[model samples]
Target chain A: MHRLALSAVLVLAALSAAADPLPSWKDGPAKQAITGFVTDVTKAGGKDFVPPAQRIAVFDNDGTLWIEQPMYTQLAFVLDRLKVLAPAHPEWTEQQPFKAALEGDLATLGAAGSEGLLQLVIATHSGMTSAEFETIALDWIGAARHPRFQQPYTQLIYQPMLELLEYLRGNGFKTFIVSGGGADFMRPWSETVYGIPPEQVIGSQIAQRFEVRDGVPVIVREPEVAFIDDQAGKPVGIQRHIGRRPILAFGNSDGDIQMLQWTTGAPGPSLGLILHHTDAEREYAYDRESHFGRLDKALALAPENGWVLVSMKDAWSHLFPPTQGSQPDE
Target chain B: MHRLALSAVLVLAALSAAADPLPSWKDGPAKQAITGFVTDVTKAGGKDFVPPAQRIAVFDNDGTLWIEQPMYTQLAFVLDRLKVLAPAHPEWTEQQPFKAALEGDLATLGAAGSEGLLQLVIATHSGMTSAEFETIALDWIGAARHPRFQQPYTQLIYQPMLELLEYLRGNGFKTFIVSGGGADFMRPWSETVYGIPPEQVIGSQIAQRFEVRDGVPVIVREPEVAFIDDQAGKPVGIQRHIGRRPILAFGNSDGDIQMLQWTTGAPGPSLGLILHHTDAEREYAYDRESHFGRLDKALALAPENGWVLVSMKDAWSHLFPPTQGSQPDE
Candidate 1:
């Protein structure tokens, strides 16, 4: 009887160990805040209980789910695409942004500003069918490596955020990506990488036209920008696509401030999270003064707005999954 | 032992009777085609078998799911709104379309054409928060009745389509409403009527702005047409919203022709269906030359495209659910 009791205890221990939903997250305030909020909202008949269908959670993609510095991975893709397409247009060699992109000069590219970057994006991203664009994006995403990390851009996805996504989904929360990047660029691999489906991804989009190409229907991307899903545009995009206000919102930069405010500001029991890139040794860490993913206003407003600031230096034990190649030499 | 055998036979018989997915659909080519296609795509190891995640079916809302005869239900809502708001604006009585709308003159209103209709839509639909619009829409849908049927517009939904939606859902298919009508107009009642949630309904939308009104974030509908999910716009809308191409498409008008062609023309086994309103006695009759849902081009091209045309008179055992009020006392 004593042996049987011991065996039972061991089995219970094994089951208890397996029950940790966010195994990648360290046992800290950030993890507690997440699990506690989920518990409070999910318990049946409770004051703060939200119905399973209404448990909407939105996450900013770049910097929140993955790295965004020294520049956005999409910006890197645009630069590379500009280089590949430069030979066809001799005018590109003389163009300000295209010349900057072709020469691999980050300083010149920065000087060219958003308008120059927009020009590069439009020239390289449009004039093709959606299916063709999907193929090009998939091929590029598969082949491209992060310059600093020396790993596939997809591999740079934060392990903690992935676990958080799975944790939320397991609790009946429908997870969505409300990103500032192009929706088409993200949809190709979001499902495989983050378990979020294509329809759940709301992002910036260029105009597209549906036409019959050789008697077959095709949606061709156009040069005009239909929507820019950054800052205030985040909430607008979310409203247009999801048609419902999210209860939980996550972000890492000032661009995501409006989205967080829109989500948690609504009259309800809600949670807002901001990931602070504070670990300089393990990852790029520049806030308030950074060129890309500047976290000034959001950092200032976090405390007053009741948003939880997650310190990457302390909260995370693992930056990325094991399969993402070894860290680069400093 | 003999009694046990009898019980087993009775159980099997009961199971077989309950297994019929489309009880409302009469045993005809339309019903057979639906069942056969579902079976082909659901059976494991079959060449055409589709995974549950990939099993998407898009349905056109206006004419395919409900009665759009005489006029569209949304148009009726807009006209009603115009009248309610007319008391505040005496100038509306002097306006061409508003005057015609107030006097219940469908002829003059129709003569005012798309531009006049657009003006009415923008005036009535915009200048409200999405939440406010939802409440107004819900209240209107619940109270307003069809003139001919004298039943709530929600009750006018075709019984066969309801069964088909449930049947597809049972077979692991995700059903979505891809309508030309306003998404906000449909979202308030879609879940209760069609079992499709707000997020699953993709439709025409005006621009929306996220603003903090009285220290609360609200998405106010703006007075500009952001997108029109009809004709060529259907495929573009589908690509923008769904991201994945649907395997099954259903519609009842020329507006859905491009959507159907896009679905069936993809390199895979697909099904495109058109619901023909041929039963003048039971319900609507005019189709090919009708003002509301013109089915001219689709009818001519159905045979060549292998699109199944469902004859309402022959294929549906019941026009609508029994609770919709018997035959409008005709």
Candidate 2:
């Protein structure tokens, strides 16, 4: 009888061990915050809780899930392609945008602004079949290095957020990315990067055409764009693609304001968090005036909307690659 | 001993019944075709096969799965709304497109022609919150009837296709709709109509803005339109949304030619089936020259593409509302 009792205790312990919820998140307020939400939703006696089936947690791609600085990762690919195609198109030599792009001077490129940016993006993104674009994005992301960090562009993603995505998914949350990047560009590598499938990634879109070239069927990009997933476009992307307003939304820029607004405005339980770029030494810190990832409107709206603003400076133990280790306090 | 042997035979029969692949499909060519495909994929010796995970099936929503004749069900909806709102909007009587719409005159209403149709669709579709639009669609679908069919618009759907959708889903097929309709308009009702969730419904779209109106957030429609998912757009829709070429493609018109071509052109194994409208007595049969839902190019391409051109006159014993008690002969 005693032996049987021991066996029963062992079985109970084994089952408990097998069901450990989040093993990666360190024990703290951050972890508690997650567990608190999950426990309330999933626990038998918790009020203001959600059921398991409705456990939909959404993430922002660019800065929230991974890195989007030094311009969106796709734009980097476009810049590289601009270099490759510069010689073929001599018109680029005299053209204002292309000339600035070819000079490798980002300041001048910034001076040329959205018109230049649009011209560059359209030129690089168009003319390729969807399949071909996937190959190009994959190849560039695999080989391209950040100009400063010298690491592969993909390796610069936030480690804690990555852990958060997996932990949430492990808890039956359907993780999705509602980003302001091009949907096609993100869909190609989203699964590999964040473990979120292509279907769950929502973003901007360019119009494409279906044509048969030499008996081969291909979907080629048109010069026309369908939508730009920025600012107001973010909410539209979430509406058109995801249908469900996210139970949780994470963003680092003003562009993500509408997304947060939409997600939080839903009647039932929801979470809206902003990733504030506050770590000066570890990462760049500029708000309101920063051109690339402007966070002014989101900052102003955060308090009014009661959004949790994560001081990237304080919230994370590490920045990226995990192997590189955190930047020194200096 | 003889009684025991008979019981064993009965038990074997029961086991086979329990494990039967699909019981919904009738015992005919359609059934045979589906069974053969599954068998080839799962059988030990078949080379052209899919491992259950990669089995993605896409359907065109408008005509293939549901009725899209006389006018798209959504158009019928906007027209009904136009009539309802005509009284409120006094300006509608004097406006070019609005005046035409109020009079029930297609030619005059769309004096803008294609652009007029687009403007009407956009005007009616936007200006409301996502929830407002959803509720509107749900309410409209619940009560509205097709003008000529004298039945609820949703009731005009092809029952066999409905069964096929459920049947495929039961067998692990992830179904998607690559259509030419507005994505948001179809999505609000697709789940209720076809058991297809919004994310899986890809279609044409217009740009929308995320805004805070009177302290409440809403997605407002922009005047700018996006991709128009028709003809060549079908294949593009499949690529942009599904990311995988559907193994099985279905359509009734030449607008779907590029889709069939793209789906069939994918190497390895695929099936492209076209529904030929030939039963005028039961349902409308005019095709090839019809202003909308034309089937000429696809019909011509079927033979060389190894597609199955199904005759509505032959394949279906019943065309719609499976329980309506209307048999083909009757």
Candidate 3:
């Protein structure tokens, strides 16, 4: 009976050890920093103890939570939408950006620049009812697959980040996604994927108007860009939507520098984390000179700002979540 | 002993009956409508049942939740600020709106129209960091008393409406204040006064820019109108902030017509209520012909739209909460 009790105690110890909040994160300085910050802030009667209502945590989407590799997921969706909508507007066949997009000519499309991209985005994203736009986005997101991963785009979300979001939420912190991505584009799937409700997701927005047609009230998406939630816009967007400065912020690019500064610079205990894409084997690794999600200024200033640099190659034991019907990565 | 047991049973029955969710609401059709709608939507497995996540309730602030007679609380605040700021700007004594404002000339200020009001608002509300502005607003709101009521403006809030907010929250509905007032102005006190957080309050906003001044990050308010949250702007603001149509909406003026239409027009169980100020003896009673909070079009369309008209005099047993040192009104 004594021997049996000893074995049961051993098994219980093993189970308890396996219950680490962030199992996908390797034992490193990055992980230790995050755990330490959370502990300090949450300890009752401690110097850093923040009330639950003030425990606001902000996260950047795209490269921070998911994959933003050769191209952004939203950009991919826009390109696909352009092709699908080209036949409806025959003039698209002759238009420069449209023709370049149809031919999959990256060079010409790049040459068309931001104005051209804006035209493409507006054409695909607006001039429809908000509900209709949401349906179209949902349908595309459901069916679309990553070019290299051969998995659904949503499946490419980083496992460690997902675990971190859940962990923060478990500790009474209100997690908000303050992204440069379009708010409407992200809201449809954010709740199901990130466990964040639409109201908590702050992002770029296009002008929308309320109208009644056939006695049915509908919000119609217009072509004008109302706000951009990027760079300096990030802090402005956070202030506008949240009205309170977040105590913790996470991001992966220079576009997030302002947000991180705004968060960590606040008085009291705070933390800023930058995800360093240094894993070339598991995920494409490019920064500074990269076309997408370039991490430059933030990286140089990370140490001075007391921002934690989470090296993907060293800190993350696993990249993507386990795929169904497939063996788990060991 | 049997008589004593009967008395105890009767006392328990009285206690249970007194535990009505909306105690300040009188026994009337309006009260019944609100309770009935909440019951139907929250019933599990019922035909009219809605998921808790989609149970959104929106309320208008001015007149609907508090007194807006004599003048809007915000307008009064602006006038008071102008008088205090007169010494800082000697040019204001010469400027048209400023001169009229400093001299307490309501007719000239009114004749100056929205342009003059905009100038007054910008001068008083902008050119300061968000934190500074918040402190200023809080100080004013804490000290400002209603001209007629002689009570703090926050104390003039409708007691029955507060009970309704609590009741809806108890039934798993998330309550949001969609007001025409400035978001920053309301955010400083909304949580303490109305039990609504800053993030859940949507309203008019001015342009703001994020700046790092002397190694400290700040958001500076600019003298530009970014978006207006009144009239047609109501539904637009609701969609921008909440990203979901509210199932229940309450308002007191024509400015809320679109919001009411958007909520009840949805293909589900919904309720729209208009608070009719008919208590001239207790509170100011003006609607259709009133200069402020004119409830003309919405009042006429309320019957056909299936909106319940709640009479302040008949449907509310109490208007304001009990004061600390005053006897409770019967």
Q: Score the docking of each candidate (DockQ).
A: 0.67, 0.53, 0.77
Model 2's DockQ?
0.53
* TM-score of candidate 3 to 2 decimals: 0.94
If both were scored by TM-score, which would come out higher, candidate 1 or candidate 2? 1
Docking class of 3: medium
Off by over 4 Å in 1: A1-17, A325-330, B1-17, B322-330
Standalone chain B TM-score for every prediction: 0.93, 0.85, 0.93
Best by lDDT: 3
Top candidate when judged by DockQ against the true structure = 3
Q: Write the per-residue lDDT of candidate 1 for residues B1-330, one digit (tens) a residue.
A: 254554454356336536776766889899999999999999999999998878889999998999997699999999889878998989988888889988888899989998888888988999999899989999999999988888899999997899899989999999999999998899888988999988899999999998888878888999998999999889888899889899999999999999999898898889999999999888888787898989999999999999999999899866676555454312
Tens-digit lDDT string for candidate 2 (B1-330): 254554454345336534543332345675567657656655556797675545777787777887777777778888877786677789888887878877888777645778788878877877666677778878888898766567776787886677667766776777888888878777877877788877788888777677788878887666667667778888877776666677878888887888888888987777777777777777778678775577887777888888777676766644565334343444
Q: In DockQ, how does model 3 score against the reference complex?
A: 0.77
| Candidate 2: pairs in clash | A41-A50, B110-B113
Q: Model 2, residue A208: displacement in angstroms?
A: 2.1
Of candidates 3 and 1, the better by lDDT: 3
Candidate 3 lDDT tens digits, B174-293: 999988889999999988888998999898999999999999999999999998899889999998988988999999999999999999999999999999998887787888998778
Tell me the tens digit of each residue's lDDT in model 1 across A1-330. 254554454345336535877665778989899999999999999999999888999999999999998799999899888878878989978778888889988899889888888988999899999999999999999999988778898999997898899889989999999999999999999999999989899999999998888988888999999999999899999888888889999999999989999998988789999999998888988889998889999999899888999998888866776556454311
